[model samples]
Target: MEHTGPDAHPWLVALEQSGLGVAMRQSLLLYPAVEILHIFGFVLLVGSIVGFDLRMLGLAARLPVAPFARHAVPLAMLGFCLAAPMGLLLFATEATSIAANTAFRFKLTCIAIGLLNAAAFHLGPWRSLLQRGEVTMAAKLGAVVSLLAWSGAIIGGRLIAYL
Candidate 1:
């Protein structure tokens, strides 16, 4: 999967050659530290998402959704803030190989779909659920999709090293 010389994508090669990428590859501590941060970020992000999705799916019928979301969403955003930059740095370190990696591609696709699903749910049925104090079918569907997409993302990410 390692693309070199004329076989490699120009932009990816350039990214791998960038100062940040060089540093990431050369530094023993930096890569592991960034990886730990990345893992923590994903844990926070996915944990919050799963908790909220479970609430939407009727796990906590007593507690309100809006209040939970108000707390969870910020944590998810914070997680994203931590994850995204570290993820970029990680990718830069091996842009050529990773961009060609099937698992990496799948993980990226899942992330995109999951984010879109969240955005759509929030913009649409989420508001309805919050305003009416009722869980709509769309809300339930959104929760299911979120769970599947995020799960797929995690699996795909893990498989990247092996695949």
Candidate 2:
């Protein structure tokens, strides 16, 4: 089905018509390259976050949390820098269809939740916990939630093809 009509978001429609988007959709090799980059980016992003979460859950109690965050957070941000633009390009390829997709919506929601959980951790208990060099129950809980949310987003992203 073709995307048209007032129901479709104007920005999405414009994106779908953009030169980059057209190339992404029409060029077989370019599409696959973008997909590969997207996968690699998310792998980096999720892997870094999971490692930090594991630490917060007491898997590496001997390691200091602040130093670890210094490394992990930057890696995660780097992954995001790689993944996000690729993801947006992929979406532009089939904007209207993806916008209407249940899995896509769920994935976005999960990402939002995951980001909020991270923000809550950083703004609240994390500040104090980092200073004192102790892991608190709240930190552990946030870690668990981060794991779940990011995992759900991955699952949802994968399911986008099938569902």
Candidate 3:
């Protein structure tokens, strides 16, 4: 692996040279398996989150948000659990190029934004949602942000291969 410019950093070099990274690159089936797992994770995470967000946005006004959130949030958390470590492993395989990739950076930024939005919502509006018996403007805004952030992350992830 040729390292140059930003990709020449020691940690990136070391990551790409690690046993996990080497194994990922050497075994075609392993890489594909990991990729499939990663895809499954995102599907669960994003799909559940989107469903919750739509509810917050008043898609199914008749359905109580609290119960929906209770069910969906756990799935989102589980998805994150599966995706995060797999993502790190995938990154290890081509740390240098992946680190330098514009799409990768965008995806990371979007993920950070999405996480922060979730945190803010849970800490703020979410606590009152049950008692309030209605979605607050803050919750709606958070839902919109969540939708856009996760969607952008997905778009950026897909573009990573091309760009």
Candidate 4:
């Protein structure tokens, strides 16, 4: 995707034309590294969360489900943190292109939905479930929703670039 519109995305234009942007663009050396790191972050995020969620669903681990849910949060957060800024920088490079793209908007909406879903889980049933000291059908349902939300977010994210 490329930039467009007469207004010329003031933010992106400033970034791309700035010293940092010029330096970033000029460096053929760093782009590949950043891209690879971003992809690695994606793998880590999906792998950690999905693996943890699946384990919580008892689809993988023989042990109890709670630990996976508890322990894997940080790893997933790390991946998300890694990807978020790079994704922003990448988007800033071509904001006008994305502004004209529905799929991009859809992807962001999905991510927001997923995040909100997660917040709901934490603020509601999952909190009580954990405090009660055992996972239940409701907890399992929550896990399933988590898995679906995250999967949706990932699929939508990938679809953004494609569209």
Q: Root-mean-square deviation of each candidate, in angstroms?
A: 1.1, 1.4, 1.3, 2.6
Tens-digit lDDT track for model 3 on 39-153?
8998899999999999999899999888898899999999988888888889999998888889999999999999999999999999889778879999999999999999999
lDDT of each structure? Answer: 0.91, 0.90, 0.91, 0.69
lDDT of 3: 0.91
TM-score of 2: 0.93
lDDT of 4 by residue, 8-28 (tens): 667756666566555556688
lDDT of 1 by residue, 115-149 (tens): 99999998999889878989999999999999999
Give candidate 1 misplaced runs (Cα > 4 Å). Answer: none
Best by TM-score: 1
Model 1 TM-score, 2 decimals: 0.96
Query: Model 3, poorest ten-residue lDDT window?
Result: 1-10
Model 3: what TM-score? 0.96
Off by over 4 Å in 3: 1-7
Query: Candidate 3 vs. truth: CA RMSD?
Result: 1.3
How many residue pairs clash (N, CA or C atoms closer than 3 angstroms) in each of the candidate models, in the order given? 0, 0, 0, 0
Task: Identify the superior model by TM-score, candidate 3 or candidate 4.
Answer: 3
